[model samples]
Target: IKYLFINHYCTLDNLFDILLYTPQLCRVNVKYLCQLHDIILNEIPIILSNLAHITIEELDLPFDVFEIFIKKMTSKLQVLSIGIISMNFTYLDVNQWEQLISQHIPYLSKFHFEHYEKMPSLSNDHHNLLKQFTTFFWIKQQWFFEIHIDTQLNGVLKKLSIPFIHIGHVLNSSILSSQGIQLVISSVDERDHDILLNDYIKSIIISTNITCLTINSSMISCVLIELLEILHNLDSLTISYSSRLLKLHGCSQQSKHHNLSTTMNITKVNMCYVTKIEQVDFILKFCPHIQYSVQMILNYHH
Candidate 1:
């Protein structure tokens, strides 16, 4: 059979037998994905070693379902993509998530967390969960970890040591304050400019080894300046909001010279949603050895 479709009535034992015979199966999509929690608990050793790729649509799954699945599959599995079809926060608990990561999915190299019912909350449970996952071997290595939180996760992110971090929410000072983070992809939707002027931005400039930086249109001018100051090793920088550059009154000649002298190795810069041509000119003048690409958008988007 090219595919396998197991109904809710299928027992866990039957599912195990089906997986054993279909080692070459490329795509396995489950309907009520959470219902297989029992099967995973019983046949983790066998199921994880054979399964290749798993996609779950509805996310009403208990935290344990994921925990058991990841624990078993981390050693052999390669790609895991979970699509949360619901918005219910109760279905997934952050504490259980931590347990799953620390105890189970430490080896995953590529992880995608998408489409949750509600945004993730940064409670003790959430912090602990991310802490556990952040330290997973997958994250510790050079893997890409993407988190889509409707809420904030800086508190949790601060404690973890991951090479790359992508946050799709309004960031607080605590989120960007960490020094070891190498790559930051963020979307800022708020209008407040003062929050971006805090010491956190300065810290990111001086401390972070960030080489790839991507931000949405709502980013502030001061944030860009801070980024310019500390991007000593940055190779690729993508900005979704170009119009914000207009508000950057003027950089002191010394500051401009300092930025150029510091960012000697920058090669690629991506600018999106810029309304003024001057912004592009300004960046090109500062980074004379770099290449630039500009995209025009009617609205600021990331």
Candidate 2:
């Protein structure tokens, strides 16, 4: 069968029987596999050698248990997500993992190893390893994926899926020189996004090549208007009044339109959350190409 779901815990005997009888099984979750067979540590390698040949495509296992197959070869295994509950990955230096990747799991494309502990910093070895790979990202506390730049980077960010996608693309010169380059951070976790906006966004934009931004924040309001107004290319804005937006009853009028639109600048304005209908009329007064509707709130809606 293509799927196998074991509702109860499995012991050593059950795993051996699975290897012998379930040759057709393509997926197996031994999350509850728990305690290993007391088959003496000397004999564990023999069982591990046999287990390595199984044609499984995905695996879920404890971090300590997976250390057995770190440098071992496995065929057809493409995806792996394991817990770092009881292990310290910093000890496994990047070169060690490079040997594992280049020699062992050559077919692996998507990998997520999560931990609940405080995040660790990437050492010099980490930077050396990342420079050789085509694409890889760090999943920060399961909130979002970040692909940051280092002094040794080549400024080529691949289009891939991951948490808090920290990206920088080289336009005219190297990415370091691309001043208006933008880092588009998107996520369903609004709380994490807000935290990123408050803490990390400023430092990142100031130190790196990030200017234009297209994002959705559930925490936007009048208190942050002056903050957002300074963004380089502020296009496609989303404002939700459900979070207590200051009403227009006691708002000041525009001394002059100042023409917020330019010939080749931030011209396209999308006014979403039509709580006040007059907002659309005000935009038409100074800006054209007005986009409305709840669906338009999404950057990819067009």
- By lDDT, the best candidate is 1
Which digits, one per residue and each the tens of the lDDT, describe model 1 over residues 1-302? 54566545444345556766666665566655545334534543544344555655454555545454455432455455665655334433435554565565554445555533222222334323332323334333433322322112333443222212232212122222132233443433334343344454444344434445555435445556655666676666566654353355565554755656555665666676666666666555555666544344544444
User: Model 1 Cα displacement at 257 (Å)?
Assistant: 6.1
Task: Give one clash count per candidate, in the order shown.
Answer: 4, 4
Please identify model 2 stretches exceeding 4 Å from their true place: 6-23, 30-65, 70-74, 83-93, 112-144, 147-216, 221-302
Give per-residue CA lDDT, model 2, range 145-210, as digits (tens): 223322111223223112332232222221111223433333323233333444334443444323
Which candidate ranks first by TM-score, i.e. highest?
A: 1
TM-scores for the candidates: 0.49, 0.40
Weakest 10 consecutive residues of candidate 2 by summed lDDT: 137-146
